[model samples]
Target: MDDVTRQKILDQIPVIDYIPKENSQAFLYLKRVLHWQQTNSKNAVLVVDDSSAARSHISALLKRRNFTVVTANNGVIALEKLKEHKNIKMVITDLEMPEMNGITLTNEIRKKYTREQLAIIGISGATSGIHSARFIKNGADDFLRKPFCPEEFYCRITQNIESLNNIAKIQHAANTDYLTDLSNRRAFIHNANHRIAEYVKRKVSYCLAVLDVDYFKKVNDNYGHDAGDQILKVLALYMRKHFGGD
Candidate 1:
């Protein structure tokens, strides 16, 4: 960044009476934000609003925080934008719009994306809280009233994104084997059940096969546990190579 831009960002940090013992979280967050803007130029958060002013205001706030942003005037355009941009991680939609409303958009988006895959936040200028409830009931991850403070907006966006990352990490740990980095037994059973169900629905013929590693325990008894672990890793890789398709 240029010196002027760097100085602008430094000036935005809250002033305090004394220097912190270590770098503040705000400082660290801003630094990471800058890095993300540079590295993730293609990834975006989608903003949907019928009003041009609202779209511009929200898009500017996101860009100021160094988030890549995509904007649409309504839910229909928003869905089109999502199809065009595969890297969108979040959607912020206004409740009232032309073409399609926010609640309907949320429902449609949830049909294709899980909460773990994409986050959605609903915003509205309406007086009734029922709109917020409807947004949540339809699958929004969060709701914010219109005329919200930027601090609250930033917090909500970051928190939801963090939640998605945390959930993905938890699922990865649950499904993946530690040593071989392949799907563990739990994941295998889960996926197999789903696939088998689909095959049955389609009236497809399928068979499950079990292969035994001959004298596998003897290899461990003779060579060592490490050698046995290596053998398992190699077998996992071979299986992936030959039968990897879903």
Candidate 2:
């Protein structure tokens, strides 16, 4: 801080949150606080495997670590389980299931949901060269070879759930407009810029218009402000209607 500003600050507050020249420590503390707030809380998991023994063992292990566990016998049953228990955070699926296998279930997961909403972990006793590659390529976040130690299994589940939570928190912070649930200014500008660039590359003609409500000032004068909020909403709706992105 400059001398004048530092003097003024010292005058305003006798004690400072950071010592002079200790900005690095302050920044470190800030980052730690942010990470703590963003970490995902504990989660529920679903175990889908053809082998009842594997399913029971894995579920028992995860439950021991304080994770809620549910089981399904096949892909069809897994889908039903998902609908019934929407809180399921991750899936520990076995590849060689009877009715529906892990691969098919992963495809459905990628098509229907998000990575943060649900994480996939592929497990198999067979060789991993082919199956593991395919599992991860599809959507599985991590994989553990069968006959692994229970400690390793629990560690993987705990880490995956924690990582998913951090990602969800960061994504929310990035995509959400703090003032409203709609996309924030940063995201809006990004998508808008991408579209304009694509249009330029394609030699497409497009008109860019800026719209704000007239007499917005009067809203502050009359309705105790934030009245312009409705106008913005209506504008968003109209834009959705008129723009081809609709």
Please list the residue runs of candidate 1 whose C-alpha ends up more than 4 Å from where it truly belongs after superposition: 1-24, 27-44, 60-70, 79-88, 111-114, 126-134, 147-151, 203-209
Compared with the true structure, what per-residue lDDT tens digits does model 1 show for residues 59-101?
8778766678999999998999999999999999999998899
Per-candidate local distance difference test: 0.84, 0.76
At residue 240, candidate 2 shows an lDDT of 64
Candidate 2: C-alpha RMSD after superposition: 15.2
Candidate No. with top TM-score: 1
Which portions of model 2 miss their true places by more than 4 Å? 1-42, 176-246
- The TM-score values for the models, in the order shown, are 0.71, 0.57
